[model samples]
Target chain A: MSIIIDEKTKLAVSGLTGREGSFHGLRNKAYGTDLVAGVTPGKGGQDVEGTPVFDTIKEAVDEAGANTSMIFVPARFAAPAINEAIDSGVETVIAITEGIPVLDMLATYWKAKEAGVRLIGPNCPGVLSPGKANVGIIPDSFFDPGPIGVVSKSGTLTYQIGNELKQAGTGNSSIVGIGGDPIVGSDFIDILKLYEADPDTELIVMVGEIGGDAEERAAEFIAAEITKPVVAYIAGFTAPPGKQMGHAGAIISGSSGTAQAKKDALEAKGVRVGESPTETAAIAVETLRG
Target chain B: MDLLEYQGKQLFAKHGIAVPSGEVADNVDDAIAAAERIGYPCAIKAQVLIGGRGKAGGVKIAKDVDEARQYASDIIGMDITGPHGEGPFRVDSVWIEGGSDIAEEYYASIILDRGEKKLLAMVSAQGGMDIEAVASANPADLTKVHIDPTKPFDAAAARSIVESAGLAEDALDEAADVLAKLAEVAREEDATLIEVNPLIVTADRNVVALDAKVTIDGNSLFRHEDLAEIADTVDDPQEQMAKEKGLTYVKLDGNVGILANGAGLCMSTLDVVAQAGGAPANFLDAGGGSKAEAIVNALEVIKSDSKVTAILFNIFGGITRCDEIAKGIVTASGQIDLDLPLVVRLDGTNFEEGLAILAEANLPNLHQEKTMLDAARRVVELAGGAS
Candidate 1:
């Protein structure tokens, strides 16, 4: 019932022979995710954490019945790996590789869109269907299967906000990290559409930061379509203008990307604006409780 | 990743675009020689990575070799206070260019604007600080066209843009040509920004690029060796070291060192620290899946920063296993004899283990907080932030 990944979704790890790929694959197994198979070009016959490794994504999908893939390839090889996953008919692909060149990502994004595949991130923590399957780098300890659907631009902020939400007794239905890159595979509206349609997701916790017009676009979408009660937190309020705080794409260039502007836009759309992570959770809990 | 004027010209030249003949000089002798070779009436420009150099006396028009030499001696190695005087004002080099008296000034740039997913090429007929003023006062004066990567730079589209921008007949054709060429250069170099501050039309009505500044994406630099070779040597020493370790590091003017797991949390940490009345010295994200070695290296980088009086460890578990971060932090605490205060804010999966590791280490002035606000307050107080 969750947005991107859920209880029934089967997943595989690309580049599973690599260090990060293997570690995450093993952790997925620890959390009881349906880790069907692993894919590494040269090390097909190898196994990482009891998951069988195949040379190609097509072969892995065929043998293990994997529909989704978590790519841990390095930035240089990430675009090709995701392309392989998408071309092989993986319904959803989560790219955990950071530092991917924007050009490569653009091509990959267009291709994924053309192929009708759901692409999550190239520099993000990925998606988590709490207590069921954890896809990206988000900490699982902060999540519980509740009624609130949480989506964030930054991966760690999702966890930070999730911890606060849990402390406030507001469990999460799903948590999606759309990533902080300017050209991420998925946009806020993409996940918002999914969360709005999901029956399990009663309320939404949206965390946006100073960057892009993604928040503005989301505000427009929420104003027109979203019926769910949404509580949002816009990060980097005190940050200077025209400077990137940390994420490569997280720079506040003009009036639109500023935190204050985002909050104002969301508020105009009837979205409860949380000034801090703690406040965001508090408001989300109240909204869900009501 | 802002480029100095000289570096920008180098990028423009690589694209076969016409620019004033110029050379970057480090001293007055080199400046005089370059000016003499280019002839008198040259522009001596201070090569700092910031703007407003002209108003700040970083730019000067030298009518003779003596004036060029004087400007080179004065502007080169001169300190320039940027707008608001927030610094980044070191002057290590100067560009001496054959100057041109402009009949008109225009503005043009190719930047990957986030509001649009594609490369955006913006043009304005007004320039020379007037362009900035125009953008601020009347933004409609700026005509922008988003370049579609699916298609080549359309000359017709560029011509339309020129017409829409209210360029004169000859200037329209010439400006359109320049835009097409710049778009090509931007694609080939994989640049994030290519700004021609003053696209000057001389008295003879020839459109010439008065200055060039290109910011290429650091991740895509593998494609362009020439652009990649312009590695900034004057970057902060701590940032340079962090870059070598494959970590994302940015040095800020604040005093509290912030080390966080994800980019979002890292930014929020800066905000929360600021809200707690503490200014963060730097913004550092150890990525989400940093191992012990990477965290240790990041901590070492933070320790080396002289401005950092305290360290804030804001970890949110999950993919960046708290236990692993804890081990790294504990090891970092012992590896480098830290003299500053440290606050650990750990949450999410395996957080208890991470906390256990920190508690076992028991370093002086090391403490853990249950809430982000509490953690921030504690570290800010230690680092002299108000209650």
Candidate 2:
């Protein structure tokens, strides 16, 4: 079966009255996600493009039977919004807001873990299951809904790889942008575990940049648990240590979290690591063909 | 953001952590005045953010006004070469404080350990030396405790930490209190790291934080307005331009300017360019949702760098439309005299339309490559050939 966001997932959009919420809500609806309800603090009676708006996530869940939350709140309110979504008993919560504070995400991440709520991102493009449902901002046009399960930290890089794979006649079962923050809701290991468990995902493609030890930890998990064919690509190989890249988490500190280190870790575990996105796609294709 | 020693001490003092009476001064006259006010036998330390200021002779002790003036003038303008090959900061200011008598030194810090998903509070009796040196030489000298996000780093825990690190019993209580205060300051200020190197124990049995270093969590800066006072905007003109445009840009010491939409792609572009026998002049990420305006701004920033002999634009449009980026590039070239060779690579959404928009420009210095590798090679060859 497909992992995370898929068919039969009822969606609820948070911050529905706001500009970003209204914009992406309609886009997701147009992409054929089960657009059930929306949430705004005070404008409960209002509707954004026929999607019902409620004051809180609890009310939206009660009225619309929504099981998943797509939070598009501003950066300052993102952590609290995720807390509300998790407390409301939603199965999954996907946050699309960027510029969220690292400490704020740390607290919110702890809360999500305690509640056992599966979370996607706080600074991400969200998740997409191709034609079935697009939860985040991933363009549905580049996807055709097939066997490759793609996960990435950067939104545009994910899109770049998606385009390359599509050109190679490869389609994805689900594509997840876990976020590009120092402290994100999910990690490479989390998505790898899910993809390993999913029957429909034949190959796992991981897109990572230099930052924390998430990729190295994922390599350990892939070696120990994941049986799926994995092709990994890490960026920031030439990045100077401590130079802040575009992504908040994309920096090399001292000798740790270098692209070379990550590549070595993954390769030592028998995982194919690619030098570039184009090469990574070919590796995935070759592995699947085998 | 790494706060300087004076700023960190001021923050520590705000939390009631005992710090030596000190004042930050930009000029030697102010520094001498501060030293006179703090009384004779004071310390004059260069207010550079980089480490090894002590080793580089940026730190000195002055017993009189003449010495203070001499030390301040000597340290303020001097460049501080760091131990990690980080920086040779041209000192702009100095922090003058009352010097301590014969005393012992210790180290204490609270850091967010990402791997363990916890807050790591570390302390070492071997303070004057680098903590990395201590951890490698005598791991037992450094005592560390992990605190949960849900729990507070209290005095009792701090006491155990300092005591275990072999702190003398007479100075243990106050040191624990200082540790707790440091932890509180770190938490309240939303700091990723709060460190007090050489947490000094004076001859009077008082526990004082001699030098402080704090890194505020950049992500959470939106909520903490007070910390913004310490945050310095990029001083480099090109980086300052990108910062103003809300684009992530880093200036480098190379010849080829690189631009891309995402951080990963931007970094990959930098790597590929270097691999193809050319050095990137800068790292500029236009971001995912950047439109034509951002593109113009990015181009202007790259063009401002005179070292850039060639420009390469690698746009992998997902949320960013290649066509929109093309319009930005074309419009920017119209705005500025971009008299450098260029290569453009477009993929994903609207590449054909993006190519068509660029095709209309007919810029003689421009070339196109469909693959990232070919584009890197083309730009490098053009840049190297021109050179």
Which one wins on lDDT?
2
Residue B155 lDDT in model 1?
A: 63
- Which residue pairs in candidate 1 collide? A137-B319, A138-B318, A139-B318
Best by DockQ: 2
Q: Give the top-scoring candidate (TM-score).
A: 2
lDDT accuracy of residue B271 in candidate 1 = 86
Docking tier of model 1: it is medium
Residue A277 alpha-carbon offset, candidate 2, angstroms: 1.1
Q: What is the C-alpha lDDT profile of model 1 across B1-387, one tens digit per residue?
A: 567887777777776777887888888888898899988788889988666788889989999877887788888778886564446577888888888978888889888866556789999887777456788898888998888767778566688887887776778888888888888877777777888878988888888899777776667766667656676463678878987897788787788998987778888888888888899888898976678998889989998878778889888776677899989877887788878888988887788888888888887878789778889888888888431
lDDT per residue as tens, model 2, A107-159: 88899999999999878999999878999788778877789999999887778
User: After superposing candidate 2, which stretches have Cα over 4 Å from the reference?
Assistant: B64-70, B385-387
Instruction: Report lDDT (CA) for all predictions.
Output: 0.82, 0.86
The sequence of per-residue lDDT tens digits that candidate 2 reaches over residues B1-387 is 778898888888888998888898999889988998999899999988777788899889998999998999898888876676665568998999888874889999998877776778898888987888889888998999888689766888788888998988898899899988888987788888888888889898899999988888777676677777556444578887777777788998788998998887898899888878898999998887779999888888898888888999998887788899889988888888778988999987789999999899887778999989999999998887423
Candidate 1 — which residues are off by over 4 angstroms? A44-50, A61-64, A241-243, A254-256, B78-88, B130-132, B135-140, B154-157, B385-387
Error of 1 at A77 (Å): 1.3
